[model samples]
Target: MGVTLFHHVGGILVVFSLFQIFFTPHCDAGNILVYPLDGSHWINMKILLEELHTRGHNITIIRASSSWYIPEKSPLYTSITVEMGKDVKDFFDEFIQEQLKVQREGLSLIAFFKLTKKFMSFLHVGHTLWCDTAARIFENPKLLKSLMDSQYNLVLTDPGIGPGVVIAKYLKLPLVLNVRWITSGEGHFVLAPSPLSYIPVIPGPGLTDKMNFIQRIRNIFSYSIILFQQNFVLAPIYNAMCDKYIEGGCDIVSLLQDADIWLFRSDFVFEFPRPTMPNVVYIGGFQCKPAQPLPANLEEFVKSAGEHGVIIMTLGTLVNALPEEIVEEIAHVFAEMPQKVIWKHRGKRPSTLGNNTLIVDWMPQKDLLGHPQIKVFVAHGGTNGVQEAICYGVPVLGIPLFFDQYDNLLRLQERGAAKIIQLHEVSGHTFQRGIKDVLHNDSYRHNMQRLSHLHKDQPVPPMDQATFWVEYVMRHKGAPHLRTEAYRMPWYSYYCLDVLFFLMTVVTMLLFSVFAIFRCLFCKKTKTKCKQN
Candidate 1:
């Protein structure tokens, strides 16, 4: 009788386990609303969307009508298009042109100021445009009600723009950020404790984790410039939106801090060690995959390099072509290299193009990077490309054009996996030297291979890890336990300034009291002596 009872209980347990395995996935499907920033940021967001869709989550994307990369129609997610009159693509194109012109003029005080002012103006205008669009979103009662009725499990957004954060708050949904760069600067500056002693602030002249006294001071000053942009420039614009839309007033930083998770797009292999929050999940290289078979012609060209291997070059999505003179110089460098080169350039073909070089308007960058025949990558140091290089173990010769590219290159340079030839410093000699150093030295490739190994060694792949956390938030409603309540505190309290003031005030009072007691005793003794006299 006892043996029969035990077998019956075991059979019931087996049935329960099977039910969970088959049915839990469908039950876990959630409705997620995404507000993604346009341009390169949308690329990362789409990757996450694909994973979630595969896991049976329903996704809805909010996109601008003029969004550069996001498609209005896709099987991955349904998009709600906002009618935006502005086309920031031209603005970005103009800025890049101006930046190139200024940078090529070489370093100067006037040139520096001109470029900085232009960059800041671009930032402000971008924020303002989003702010206006967010207001229009709030103003549409029908749209607002539709969103309310949909009852999304959470808002998945890139906090590089403020609209998503604002919308998340208004809807009172759980927030998860797909982030590396936030509105002001690196995501950590706002989300975690950044000690300037070691953690260098970006957009300054390149400094590393190791710094002297002068460099530390420069870091603080650079950080102050970031604060100026955040508080003086961006806050007022977003704060206005908050006051109008949110039931109670909210701030951008507070909304960001309240997020349940941050699917951070970098790891220690590519990023310097720094303080990170519990909720910040490192999903660097999540978008990377094994190389697919290349096109017949591309494969034929790659194989033609023989044992020397091929070098691939591309300037990323924004900068389609370099200045003609720079392009000609780069072509000249390729002419000297024994290895064949494939360059993605939209400009007129260089007169110096060698028989060993092929120039195309596009290349399958990730697939090419994964190819064993590829020796070195000549790229703009964008986050996606940098991480991809690490994923594929390809050493880089970076020609950083503008905005965060130099900083990204600096991280790899520090690790000895890549070399940067800044725009102002790029010439045939420098370009050729950088390429040859990476290709022949062997150490650059070895170091990058080590990084690739470390990056791939994780138990859960970055993409799976990112998706698990997104679902975790959906299941739990929000991961408030992982989030820090420090954001809720006043600035003085958060920094312990009030406690310091109180302790100092008490010590000062005690010292004054001791002096008074001594002074009173001395006065009485002097009076007695005078009376005796």
Candidate 2:
């Protein structure tokens, strides 16, 4: 009886031990390597990395020396910086200059298209240079061998960098894309569903899910243009980089198709309704938080304004400085406003600077936007800034310059949360009136607050959702089951274009055959009639 009792206790102990061994943490102290292309990408990635680090995952970041922010070396996170031999920040500055030049000249209908084509070409060149510079890191034999042996659980890539896909493939690691932009330029079709019928290919032309006949035609044309550029232009640039850096050619399309997960910096609140696959996750306001206390000077400034409130103006990191005349015109407008203004000016202070307005090279944008006295936010309409405004329930007066800024602002306008003044259209009266309208109107505030509530009222915080999914992908070893079957289907078959063509071809053949037979019978009958005659 004693032996039987002891045996039963031993069996229970063994079962408990096995359970503990098999069911530990989902992540299992896994190593995660992240490649954030630039400051913009890094800003979106920063909060996600913090969450992952706190969760006991080993985090490694490969940063460019020109990266705006570099986290300190610690046990939780480490970084490897690649010297690009040029200030990458200059790229943004140059791009902005070109945009300002065009805005100044007022783009002609033909010149606008030509300018767009030129800018896209220039962007490709920059991407090539970026990828080539990044490839230098892999040239180090020891580092490459160490990374290969480490067997990282996941490779978090910013698809903005063309070479990131190739590097992940070379390491033989599972790929998870961190796309920071709303625009789907970077081979995203592989993992996400881009039904062009309803989805606006670009930002404007008054498009929504319920598009009119003309709008649908415009959507198709926009998608066709984008597809042509991606396939004919972007694909070759990426493929060339792959051949130079990777052993087995990592095609961009193939890499995206094999990606385990995609964390988009977007949300349903901002985007029109569109189809999404299992592997795609939206964490739009993941990095955003409620306003923090302002600095003493800024606090006092807002306090002094009293009932008048304050306005915040910024063009984000990319365009820290604006054209001189535009700044002067803005300064003049701010001088006349009843509210106190805080302008983030990187260039020389405008001579029209007012006592009511303060000029700074940088400002705590999110915190300022969250302030109660803050009435309006005049910005360039970057996704992060727009989302931050939405998070804080701040009404925007957008002065969109380029890229998706125009589209982002257009969407905000559609939602009645913002007003837009194009770069070329920014005059003293226009800028001032735009600000006055948003501040005076109750509708903008109401819509923004509603969207803010919707954005915040989520089943789980976006940060946790992102972290859980990242770990989930790692735990499951690539999460192949989560990927959509669409990736496996060819482009022709995916859209059913091939099937439609085949059916059409068969019907045409049958009709022709019938016509031929009818003609033959008619000829025979005519001959018979002639013979009878």
Candidate 3:
């Protein structure tokens, strides 16, 4: 009996030891490699990473050698540079080759070849690369091999496509897709604009803007042909090269499909009609940290405006090339306004300036938004700027340029938080009216404040949600269960409702035929009985 009891005690000890070994926290800290393309992208990424570091997550940023713009000093995060093989010269060379091929062949193959060549032109053979810099880390057999051998649990990526998604998919690692802007998915519930919303107008917006019924019909066909060329021909050509070089066997949409979860930097207040994907989460207005104090000069500038306050104008990063006529019109609008204007003019300043108008090459956007005296934001409706305005509960007068700016402005307009003025149609009258409407209207402010409350009253802040999801991926050893099985189904199977309807029609027809046959047989029997009588 003593020997048996001793054996039982030994067995329990063995079981406990095995459990400890299997469930022990091997990854106390996770290694997060970020790949943000440029300045704006880096700043957005920095906000999220800073929050994660604060919460005890290990973070690393890998960027291109030329991308030297640092928005913030992050001592906790380490930065590495991946060298590029070729520079701008190689890009031009590839462009020329592709153009020449297209001229010669007039076919889709040339377009695809040129895209691949252009991608290669930018990178140094084996040392440097394009697409997302994160791919380099994965392709670095040494780094990836070590991580695979070790116990790092998760890899968080951004823009949801390109190198970042490819690395996560190839490693069979769990990933969170940080969709900062609009992706190919037309119906994502993020603050980002849909690409379909920006389809260019033919004969431009000038003539087509006021087209009659016949003209509208003709324009639709023309637009369809252009769209067909762009989507079927041009886009596919570009995507094929992206698949070959950047993604290593996968395409952009396929990468998005493979992600464990999607984190959107937007709120439902804007009302983007998105499909109900179980893994997608809307966490907009994430950059709601307290603002840093404004500079003394900037503070003075606002105070000098007195009761009227200021109207801040900026045409975001990409569309800095404002036509001289538009600049003149903007100058005229400011001249007539009751409020002082602070314009972020990236190019040459206009010769005529009103006493109330202040033109600066660049302004501290967030700091300016936080100011109590600043009443209106005259913006290009970029997702970042739009969210910042909402976070601060400030009204916006949007000048939509390209891409998702139109949709972004429309969403804001629908919510009564802002108004939109198309870039092509901007004039002194329209500009002034838009400014007055947004600044004077009490409703815009009320709506903005309501949204601000909703944005702030989350179970966790946006950054915290980002951190929780990141760590959750690490803890679960790649959240395989969250991945959608949509890819496994064929295109035909996915549109299965159509297939079901087709089958139902066939079954109904067969049943009707059988009923008719039985009725005919009964009638023949009745006729034969009548003949016998």
Candidate 4:
């Protein structure tokens, strides 16, 4: 009876301790806010925020006034402006000035080294500092001060913009890094587009032939340099500044060491060397939300395409500036096709027009895909567009231009949900054949539908996962336990080659000693026998 009583007491204490550790001080769920630097990001943020709001969590969104590439006239502009507060612009201006000061100083080596070491330690942490040109403009000390004072549970930031990550660290807030593309070592999983979608590969006669070997080499080297700057240099420096300036004394990785959860939008189908973090959650197909209602005229226009159906064409926001010659080739291909084409041209239309082809400067993409008459989508394979197509259960013909587009299309191809055509090889025949194959092929549609169902059938949508994790951090007073011990291990030690060599040497010595002893014993025995004889 005494022993049993003691055991019961111990059990109660253990339970109480666990509660004190995880639920102490009672986390304020209302103090959660999301920062998506630009308007395009609002789409995904909106889905997650709406779900969270419905669940009775207070959420605030900081919206950027404009993006570098996307103009104010774009549909994305209006979407952001609708719910945007004034905080984003104010924050961005301050962020830019601070960044420029650091850059002018050429980044302090001491700070850089210190931050890099910290990053190396917790390399497995899902937190990443994104450094893109546009993001630099959005960092604001005053906004950070407000958030810090508010005691917000956590800050979720997009990768490619260093300022957000830096500010989160500065404010000593827990952060979740959102990787939108296949960027450096930051992404737990990278979303890449198809190789055929690249500008160099997009089908065109004599495209590669025009460039000499030296020019091609120069281009490849130039791309590598740009990647290096973004990944190795800028990312680390930005992180250091956040640590030194924002957190007062703590570095970026130390700030990140408090965070372990990452919400990735990439599937294995897109990125190679799939990154693993202690708490990374893959949520690639999350963008596959239900299609929005179509405009009356747009719905009618798609319905007019009939049994053969229509093909949708879009080059995405970044690379819509295609040369006239390539546009002409695309135009010619559409003219030859028996299937009607709905082309989303960002710029002026080509002179070559066909009765079957309807060229518009822009079209409501999700609505068009939802239309019954739409059969296939030809796209630049941007992450957002790909997810939308998958959600709508539409097959794609990926024409990747650059960056993660190759990786994104590769994912689609691996899933048998899309076909990839090289941009340089884009000819009338190739375009026609590729379109026909996707339109006529039963397998493409079947694979897309199957994946779409799997994507949609998740117990909670990606937005839910995103929201839950965010809330979980709040509820737990920050999920610090998820942070990895990678920071403790040096780069060389993480690889374990040093330990491996040490073990190998010890084993080799032991074997050699044994062999020598055996040889010595045998020799002694032989000498004894000879002497005895």
Model 4 misplaced regions, further than 4 Å: 1-29, 37-42, 53-144, 180-186, 189-232, 239-243, 246-258, 267-278, 511-533
**For each candidate, what is the lDDT?**
0.90, 0.80, 0.65, 0.61
- Tens digit per residue, CA lDDT, model 1, 367-426: 999999999999999999999999999999998888789989999999999999889888
Tell me how candidate 4 scores on lDDT. Answer: 0.61
Off by over 4 Å in 1: 1-27
What's the candidate order when arranged by decreasing lDDT? 1, 2, 3, 4
lDDT by residue (1-533, candidate 3, tens digit) is 99999999999999999997898544357777565555455567777877778767776655566654642335867666666444433443445444434433443755645554443333322112344344556568887776566444556666522556555666667767777442322324222222323322322222213347665665565446444433443345336545654545555555666667777777776545434566667767676677778788888888998999998989775444476767888898898777888888876677656888888877889988888888999988877888888888888998765445666776778778988877656777888788888888899988987877777876867876766677777777656576668666675776697789889998998998998899899999999999999
* Candidate 3: regions farther than 4 A off: 1-27, 68-76, 84-151, 180-251, 273-275, 497-502, 505-509, 512-516, 519-533
Is candidate 2 or 4 superior in lDDT? 2
Which is better, 2 or 3, measured by lDDT? 2
- Tell me the tens digit of each residue's lDDT in model 2 across 128-162: 67766767877888878877887799898788765
Q: In angstroms, how far off is 331's CA in candidate 4?
A: 1.8
lDDT of 4 by residue, 1-533 (tens): 99999999999999999997797444344655455645455556555555666666655544344433223343221222222222333444443344333433444767445533443333212122223332343355565466667766777766444455555655566777555532233343122221211222211111221346665664455445434544564456555555446534443333343454677776543333333655676677665555677777677777777787889899865444465766887888888777788888876678776888887777888778877777899998877888888877899998766445655676678779899986666667887788889888999999988877766776666775676676776676666687677665665896788999999999999999999999999999999999999
Identify the superior model by lDDT, candidate 1 or candidate 3. Answer: 1
- lDDT of model 1, residue 187: 88
Candidate no. 4 TM-score:
0.68
Model 3: lowest-lDDT 10 consecutive positions: 199-208
